[model samples]
Target chain A: MSTLTPTVPAKPARGLRSTEGKAPRAQRESPFARVSAMIVMGVFTLYFLVPIWWLLVAASKNRSQFNSTNPLWFADFSLFENMGNLIAYRDGVYLKWMLNSAVYAGGGALVGTIIAGMCGYALAKYNFPGRELIFNVVLGGVLVPATALALPLFLIFSQISLTNTFWSVFLPSLVSPFGVYLARIYASASVPDELIEAARLDGAGELRTFFTVSVRMMVPALVTVFLFQFVAIWNNFFLPLIMLRDETLFPVTLGLYAWNSQVNQIPVLRDYVLIGALLSIIPLIIIFLLLQRFWRNGLSAGSVK
Target chain B: MQIKKRAAAVALLTAATVVLTGCASGSTTSGGDAAACEPSEGKVDLTFTTWIPGMEDVAAVWNEENPDVQVKVQTGPNGNGGTYQNFFNQLKAGNAPDLGQIEYDALPNFRVQDGLMDLAACEGVLDAKADFVDWTWGQVNFGEEDAVYAVPQDAGPMAMFYRADLFAANNIAIPTTWEEFAVAAEAVRATGGYITNFSQSDINQFAGFVWQAGGSWFENDGENWTIDLASPESVKVADYWQDLIDRDLVSTNPPWTDEWNNAYNTGSNWTWNSAAWGANSIASGAPDTSGNWSVALSPQWAAGDNAAGNWGGSSTAVFKGSKHPYEAAQFALWLNTSDEALTMLNKSANLYPAAKSGLELPALKEGVEFYGGQAIYDVFAEASDHVSPDFIWGPTMTQVYNDTSDGFKGAVTGNGTLTDALTSAQQSTIDALEAQSIPVNK
Candidate 1:
């Protein structure tokens, strides 16, 4: 991690031919190659970064400037006003929605990630009966889209009298098929059998060995799983739209949607909707940025080993 | 083994307790409280759902007036989808609120389905049936006998709102006829900018123009359905607008979006085709553009012989599952057509009342400061009388609008010619209406 590549071609004064033979021919390279690469990467960066930049600049503008001012440039600093309006609109209901999202995402992802990790570890290390069949079934769940299952889940929840409750959303979020699949793939590759065996030999039980050793080794992968599940639950709209009838119980996505649909009729809500969209995406970006190191570590672990 | 058995037994007991408690609580409360309040009704709890603008104030007023009856205002999806879905779910669940907001076009749907209570059954309710304009009343009843599902609240009578300054600068007058209007539009385009902006992207607005031109999407002869997709009225109106787009006399943008708002606020468009409700949006959103704007009667088609038409209106209905039908009906009537209620709505958000008496209020007669002191209500009220009585909205009207709007996008956006666009839209609408089991002419 600390070493830098040797510069100046190892100072081989008499071996230019040998170095030339070893290195690929530079004559094959196109003139536009570097330029095109730079342009492509520049565009890719702009495509992502521009929206975030606009969000920051627009969030600083007051209601009037939100419509009239340049979307890309900074206007009068009114992030305070925007935040104030957001908090005070409908008597601070926006804050409640933010809190609800945090609870739903934070708690849901935590519990869901732990379950996925355990399930994945069990499938990867243990020689259980029907293991392949169960793994295949879990993979099959990924093929069926979330929207197709929402109505079925609604019906099931209604049957169990669980509709219109926190558990209706939280319970479904916990059973993420994609999370399970990713975790399983990661566990098989990242958590070595030697580590588990070492822990077991050190007088640890199966559950204790899995938790203390396997979990520590799988931290990077588990964090990746947690972040993905958290963002998914945070942005979930359709399920909450169907399940929750009470406006007070809505997550930010559904809440902002309800606000957006009315912006046409009530023009005052246009700025509010834009500002809300701007505010809601900030936490998502921050979460991704903070967790990226762990995610990258997890991705490159097997390559290093 | 003993310890394991004890834990298992404890878990089973806990699960049983949770299930029993969950089942026991909800049934016990609703029955005990809702039933207790049902007969005597001293402190009535009314759950009301609506999408009407300024409804919170109305709820506040009702709460103040009837301190004994606690009214809870629930809003559905801010637009049509939420309103329809919530209404559908509530009806299916048999737990709909006491009152629901019904649009004039959707009243027939509710009427056909037996989803509403008969408002005639409630006494001491304001007799708003006679107060509303006869056509508005007809709109509420769905042309059927003995089935009055709702009372009229407001009618959206549409007109051409033009900038007087732009017209004067262009040396043009408010065109009195459709042909003259086309010429004026051209001159305005040559002088100022885009001459006019109607939401070609909105099918309902297009249908209003088609209906005003005496083109019916469906015609019923008291027994059977008659579909008319290629009526002369339909073709003429469609062609006129398509020609306008081709000539670059109108905007290509959808209404009420950023493009539309830009055109409106910047005076890029000389005229806007809108209903009376548009006045409130204009007044509030673009306060600086006040004195430049004025209202005029819509240019009439030579065939229709009228300068006006209806676009949107709201009705108040008592849902079938309402616990307080009598109170709900009384409140519905009072809220719908009473002069006091309309006055409150108009004051808050310039909602033009459907009731004739409500429209006849001193407030309604006054000119709006926002429109260069033009008597906005007086113009709309005059237009209300000339509004085509035979503007029959079919059950598949929304579907037809969506199809036509999608089709016009190609023409307006310059992707295709008008004839081809209309043809595609006509075919799609025919398919859509047929799928909905609404009869269409071959």
Candidate 2:
């Protein structure tokens, strides 16, 4: 692919023995280069950070500040006040939503990651009959959007009497085809064949070999899968909105949306919504930052492989 | 390897046990017989669902008053009808909220769907139902006669809210008649101020205003969908608005949103068309500009127009299959139309009293501080009196309005003639109605 391109322009095709002889001088900087770069980066930074900054500022204010104060600026710091209000609102339901989200995300991601990692490792490392067909089917699953599958999932859950339960959300998160695909690519590159072959020669059972050797090698890939599934489950809204009727069962996203809708008529909820939005972003950010070291290590190992 | 398999088996069993325990706990409590809650037990868990913001105080007051029956309030998600949809799903699941808020436009939809309990079966609530304004009560009427299934929350009486300071600055008069209103708009335009703020892009509001001009969207047979869409009355209103848009006397504002709020707040437009609840949005959100604004009677279409059209209001209904029906009905009546509840509601959000007796409170008597001490409720209550009960609404109102928005935009933006726009709107409305199996005018 690299060799297909012509080295010289049509007019200069026959002029030189080596194109390296005609290297051009360093180009002069354009008049507006620095200014344009600064403008672009400025807008890009503001585009991402302005709303977040506003959220942080707005989250600190009480209901009155939300209504009366400048939206982008900090007023009297009422973060504690807002937090107190949130916890106290309707007998600490916000805390319950948070706990529910943590349970759903924590339990679902742990199980999902293990299943994806093992499946991906097997598909990549083992040369079994019908492997390609199974992989193809898993790849095909990636094409279907989650929302398109939600109604079918609901119907299935209804038949099984699992519609309004935690399992309805948990079970669906475990079947992540994209997670499997990622794990397969990572495992294929990371785990060498010699390791598996050596383990088998030592008379180690297949399950023992996977547990002691391949699974350990797949840690980074599994963690990545866990984080991906964790965020997906944490932010899950529409399915829960459709499936769950009990307020006690609601996740924070659905909970916050419920508050946001009433802000029009009940102006006081405007602050609650702003505060809720600010709090919502914290868990995801903390998770990302905490697990970033593992991600970096995964990248480096991939390069070595 | 044997040890590992055994450990996995133990872990799986633990997880299964946890799930089974959760299910067992739920089933033991609510079980197959959900309606087993006895009123005589003296402690009932009555769930009141609503989309309204300030109903908590109302529930609190009721709870405070009644030591025996406890009411638990659950609010639906804001703007999105999550609560209604959730309530509907619960109804199917046989665990519907004991009491819930219903929107006025959605009353007929609920009635037709068999989703609601017959509130006529509720013994004590029906006694107070007659005390509400007939038209307000008329909204909850499903069939020809008022076989009430829901109680009114508020009457959305519209009036012209104008920036008095801005009008004074431009020397524009608040017009009494439709002709004078057009002239006033022109004069305002000459002074470089927008005379009105309206979302001509919303055909529902357009249809609402047309209805205010004594036009019906459909005739009595319920099949003939006729509005004075292009009738002399409607065309007069449309052409008058079109002239405003063309001559730059109207601000190109969308209704009841941040854009419209900003437009009104920034003094980009001098006047807005709003209801009793509409004024609440303006006054509450813009407190600093209170003295600068005032309300006037919304300009009449001709000599005598029913100065009444609804924008939005909520109602309370008993969902079918609630466990504690009688207790739920009691709580619903108390939270919705009770004088004490309305009084509490007034303190929190200024919701207009749904109960007729509630309209006579000190809050109603005392002039509103937000409207420069103008007697706001008295004004709205008078307007609510003239609202025609004959303006019957159907289930397809929302769908028809959505389909006709493009035509409304075409007319407002001057890309099409008013007659063509309305003609297309009328046809689209019929099509939408027919799609729903709702009768349309021939």
Candidate 3:
């Protein structure tokens, strides 16, 4: 396996024209091609960003101003006040949900990533009887939707007295077959067998050689797997909704959903729900942006192999 | 060496999944013999799930009064179909709350699942039965055996909440009859406004109109159900609203949503034919319209016909899961009949009371500032009396409500006439009932 050169160029606008300029004269495209592409990209960016922009603005408005004022822009600058109320509501229940979410997503993704990475690395770098069979099974697990598993998983957890606890959600979320598949492909591409042999020759234990040499090469793949599992665990609603009853154990997404259901009865909670939605995404955005460098390399590496 | 580890991990993964998936337990609460309530140490911890706003305070009163049984109030989804779905899910999981807040319309759906306990067996529940309104009493005493499935909590007897300022500005006299309402609808449209937002999605709203027009949809003698959904009275109700839809005098937005909020916020729909709870819901959605709104008795079929309809209200029902039926029924009765509980419920929930006692509560008597300081509940109180008793819902009210709502969608979108929708909805109801082996008298 070899490194896959990233298909998305460093600058698409420049790359499209520069790559084309090298071709024959008759094949040359119109001058407006790049401009039109840029326009299309700009329109898509706006289309995607506008709702988030509106949410950010909506979070700042009070209950009265939410519907009465301009929808896409800020009015009363009540973001702080609303956030304060959201935190203070039901005696800081929102913060508890946020903590629960952090525990479920962060801890689950970390554990899932380690297992997935190790498993993927083994599948990609090693060959044994029934290897393809195992790979195919893991791929099948990836295709079986999480929602379909939620109730059955709940019943399983209930039998074991874990349904209402954090473990119910955390345990199911930790099995990321897709994560393992990514790790396997990434490991084959990045971590050379020769490096492992060299480490082995130095008399390093199998575990030691794998940790010191292979794990370092697998960092980008591991982070991508972790982020994938993290977002899935964070946004998970049905699993938590069906499994947990104690409000104290709820994730932010489920908590917001519960609040939103009562919005018509308590209109004031609408502001809190909007603000909570805005704030819940900020952490995910920050994490994604922070790890994007690793993600790009890992994605390209996976594709190339 | 790595090959061995790969094979080991795959085997382990497969083994783990097998164990996890294999652990799928038996279907929840399969044996009908859920053990009778054994109050340990004469103290039972009960979980009551409800969507009623301010239910916690009522629970607190129950807790304070009865130290022997601790009540934990869990919030369920709102009464608009979500609560029923949640109830069904919990019931399936065999972990439903001991007491579930069920709507009069949705009660039968839970009953059909054998999820509810017959309250007749619970001590003292029958004595407290006389405390609720006659119509509300009829709702609880469901099925052919005349069994009480639930105790009424709050009600939503319908009324026309009008914008007095808009009507006065237009020189439109208060509409006392359906013809006058149509005239006012046209007057409002003349001013580039709508009289009301006829939500194609709110089946409860349409049902309320039918109730006022003297249509039951279903009737039972504790044995066989007679479903007459397309009764002439109901057809008349549908035709009247259909005429309004054709005239474009009403906006066909879905209710209790952002789009409907926008219509009210902009004064597009100057009137609301809603339940007593509409005042609180309106206060939440369009607080700026306060002091401009007022309540009138819902417009009539005939000039002197004083019948009314109900849209949303719920009852506290004892699930078959209750370990202590006596205590559960006691809690349900107290939540409805206790003076402290009733006052707190009305104050916090803003639900029109199904209990006759709630009509006299000071909290309910207070003028709602949102309706321009009108004691608007008086109209709803009168409307509650007018709510035609003996109007029984079929076991498939949820499916029927949805089917009828879909009909409204057809009418609104020009795919079918309102009369066609009624005919289709009635046929669907009869077909669905017959499929379920319930008797359907078309």
Candidate 4:
């Protein structure tokens, strides 16, 4: 491990070119080609970034400025007032929604990641009967759209007297087949069979071997799975729209959507929706930044092995 | 080992089945979901879902007056898609609110689903009928021996609001007839202005014109519905708008959109062919244009025609699941007909009242500053009397509105004319109904 570690930093420079091409890292390329590449990337960056910039500027304006002012420029710094309105409008309902989103995403992702990891690890390492059939079924689940399941889920939840409850939303969010798929691929690649065999040889039971050895090796992969499930649950609008009736229980996305829909009826809500949207992004960005180390480790670990 | 594996799989399968059925059995299908109408201990608690804000304060006033019943308000804001769909889901679950504020057009949609209880059966609910204009009452209390399903809360009688300064500067009289309006539209366009904005996807706005032209898209005959949305009267209205659109007299941007908002706010559009609700929305949206605006009667199809149209409005309905039907009915009546309720709603909720007593309320009678001290309600009051009576809404009015709205998109996109909008929308409604084996008159 020590001998390979010193060479690892030097390895990727030579390694990437073999896969990318034998071309010497674009250094020998034309200046025109380089300039064009820079321009293309710069334009694409602006395309994605301008809307976000617009939103940041827009959240500050009141109703009249929202209508009359230039869309790209800041008319006034009424963001604090807009935030105040958003928070104070319905007795701090915006913060309640933010907390609901955190609970839904954090709780749902934590539960989803554990189940998906166990199932994926079992599928990858075990030789049980109908294992391929199970894997295939999970793969098929990845192809089915989440939206297609919501109505049926709603009907089923309704019959069970579960609709409008928090579980109706959280339970549906926990079924992330794609997360399981990623986990299976990740587990097979990251955790070697010989390590499990060694643990078994050390008088470890099946459950203990998997928990102590396999789980430790799978931490980075599981973080990736947690993030996948977290984002899916976080941005989920339609499921919550069908499931939750109480605004107090609504996730930030659904709450913002309801407010956004009311801009026509109550125009003052327009600024609130914009500010709320800008606020919704902050948590997702925070989660991403906080888990940056795990995300990077997960990506690189697969390649190095 | 093989036997153990198979047995474990079978056990798992059995457990899943048991859990599924156990969960399925929890549905309260046969009743007992909702409490009964009578007061339980001493005071009654009422729940209401509304789109209008500031209603809670009015309920607070009601609570202070009558200590026996305390009201809690729940609002869904947008009122139609999300709120109405949730209401339906709640109805199916047997947990619907006691009273729901439903739009006038959608009252039939609720009635067909048994979502509303007939207030006619609630006793003394209809006593307030004399306090409201006869037409607003007609919408809520029509069909099946004209049993009332809801009480009129507000009405949006259609009117024309224009930039008075813009018109006077351009040497235009308030265009009274459609022909004169088109001529003035060209003059306004000469100075890079629009006569008004046209919302192709807003079927409700277009329906107002069709109503003023004396067309009801749906006619009920016993068990069947006569779907005649493509009738000569509707087509005439469509043709008039299509011709103006082709001439570039009106901007074909959809309403309630950012593009339309910017254009309307900036005076790229000179007029608003709007319902009484527009007065509040415009004042809030573009406060700079407040004093420059003025109200006129909805333009006539022919010169001197007094026929007018109604647009959007909502009524307070008593749900079938309501525990306090009597209390709910009384509350609905009090909210609509009582002088205090009308004034409160007018001042706070900005509703154009449908009640006669509301006409005398100082808030309603006072000239709005946004309309340059114009008593806009005076115009709406006269327009309310001209609303064509006995307009039968269908069991699927929402479905019709959405389908027709989609059809109208083609007109704006220039894929087809408004004529196609009428025909396609009519055909779509027929196909939808016939597919369900509902009888349809061709």
Cα deviation in Å at residue A297, candidate 2?
7.2
Model 1: pairs clashing at backbone N, Cα or C within 3 Å: none
Best by TM-score: 3
Error of 1 at A260 (Å): 1.8
TM-score of 3: 0.88
Relative to the true structure, candidate 1 reaches a TM of: 0.82
Error of 1 at B176 (Å): 3.0
DockQ: the better of candidates 3 and 4: 4
Worst 10-residue lDDT window for candidate 4 chain A reads A1-10
lDDT of 3 by residue, A143-181 (tens): 999988876786666567676677889989889999888
- For residues B205-245, write the lDDT of model 2, one tens digit per residue: 56657656765554333123344345675676677777767
lDDT tens string, model 1, B1-442? 6346534543453344334323434344321111211232577788777655457777788889988776777664553656665565556555567888877777645543446665544564335566777778767655543336677788888787888888887679788788988898878787658878756666666766776776666654432345566577878888888888878888777776656666777788777767877776665455557788998888887734655767888888888767777677667777866677788787764678888888798898887788888887888888887676666665555666666676677677777765565667667766754553433565
Fnat for the candidates in order? 0.12, 0.28, 0.31, 0.49
- CAPRI accuracy category, model 4: acceptable
Better of 2 and 4 by DockQ: 4
For every prediction, compared with the true complex, DockQ reads: 0.18, 0.21, 0.29, 0.33
Query: TM-score for every candidate vs. truth?
Result: 0.82, 0.78, 0.88, 0.84
Models, CA RMSD each: 10.2, 10.9, 8.4, 9.0
- In angstroms, how far off is B338's CA in candidate 4? 3.7
Model 3 misplaced stretches (Cα beyond 4 Å)? A1-36, A125-129, A198-206, B1-41, B53-61, B79-83, B143-146, B220-226, B257-259, B433-442
Off by over 4 Å in 4: A1-44, A122-136, A192-213, A296-305, B1-46, B55-72, B77-79, B302-305, B321-324, B339-344, B412-415
Among all windows of 10 consecutive residues in model 3 chain B, the one with the lowest summed lDDT is: B24-33
Model 2, residue B144: C-alpha shift (Å): 2.0
